[model samples]
Target: MQRLTQLITCLLGTLLFGAAAAADAILPKPFTATYEVTYRGMRAGQITFKLTRDDATGRYTYETTADPSFLARIVISNAAVERSVMEIGPNGVRPLEWSLDDGKPGTARDGQLQFDWNKKLVTGVIEGEKIELPLEPGLQDRLSIQIDVVTSLLRGEEPGLIPLIDDNRVKRYSYVKKETTSIDTKLGKLDAIVYESTRQGSSRQSRFWLVPDREYLAARAEQIRKGKVETVMVLQSVQ
Candidate 1:
């Protein structure tokens, strides 16, 4: 009778755990977060980023505005990359091709994504590259980069990064876990799952935070590579 009871209890516990996981699978995520980025310089960049769910197509759009002239608006879907480039010194902005691949020239439109063993959807190609954020000494310039990606998995969303490798570029992302993190914004804190990427041999961390209740990354933070906290590279706006 004792052994039978123990087995029954274990089975019940397993069932409960499965139920909880399923419930977490369908939670809505963040739609958008307008933030600012700053580095060593006091320069500022205005950013409006969003993660919108097509609902009909089940695809998500990860988009942001960092450069005002060159790379103004970038929209990335599961396998599509769309960029709007501004023609300088003249008329207006024109659309350009955007690629999010690692080895290939990437596409002018869309990036490739895949699912891990945890069933969380994430970026598939691992491109060894890094894009440096403009900074100044003694002062952190505020800048923001919008992120838009699709899928039921929103794990690569957070601020700060732990780069794994870097020959040309450092690589870093989030570890799948059950911790509750809040996406820090100038407005307030919103709960999210943050991922990060970094170039090798650097002491900085930029993170992507996905608010499960929403559909996209609500915020991101880049810390300079200083002592203890290291020097941080988090600008609220992109100039």
Candidate 2:
């Protein structure tokens, strides 16, 4: 009877440990996804997004590269890149650094930001100007904000106002959960949850169709201004 009791206790401990491990594995596995970009109903460009992690440091790097078509290049860039490096902790995902390149050499649109949590400040250079802004809890960079939304949805929580550093200023965008619907994509049909995000005091709205099965990745995204669609992106492939 004593041996049997010890075995049962050990089994129970193992089960609890397994449950904790599963809970900690909520984040999506690293992946590379590509999308077809459109502007005003015309084929414009392609975007490749990548998410990678450093197991040793528990840090993540999310990057997006945009290659525009010749016509699109007139409005956009030949090649643009945005990257965010962040870490997840008790307070949530915190961005340590972020950088953007508009693909124009010596252009003013290229900049980078460094976050200092200990000092509660974010310092960066934007458009040939220096910036130093006070940091608030739950602050995020442009790329990290997407991960924050995905993390919140996976945890069964509503994604509230996202405070992110844009350019040289902090902007707040509120996300509103809409509906669950089926969307046709290059990979086939998928069920996705629709979300609309609007910047405070702005008429421009962004919409996302996130597939839960794909780790809440956006299968389709659009930008609307005054009820007119300005830009759209559809998932083309993932690996």
Using Cα atoms with residue i matched to residue i, what is each candidate's TM-score against the true structure?
A: 0.36, 0.87
Q: What digit string (tens of lDDT, one per residue) describes model 1 on residues 1-239? A: 12211111111100000002444333223343344433343323343444344556444343443332122122212222222111111111111212232112433222322222133212222233322321211111011012212121333332232222111222333323334577565536777655443345545433445445544433444443433332122224321
Candidate 1 residue 191 Cα shift, in angstroms, is: 9.4
The candidate scoring highest on lDDT is: 2
In lDDT terms, how accurate is model 1?
A: 0.29
Q: Name model 2 segments beyond 4 Å from true.
A: 1-21
What is the lDDT, from 0 to 100, of the residue 78 in candidate 1? 24
- For residues 204-224, could you state the per-residue lDDT of candidate 2 as single tens digits? 788888777766767788877
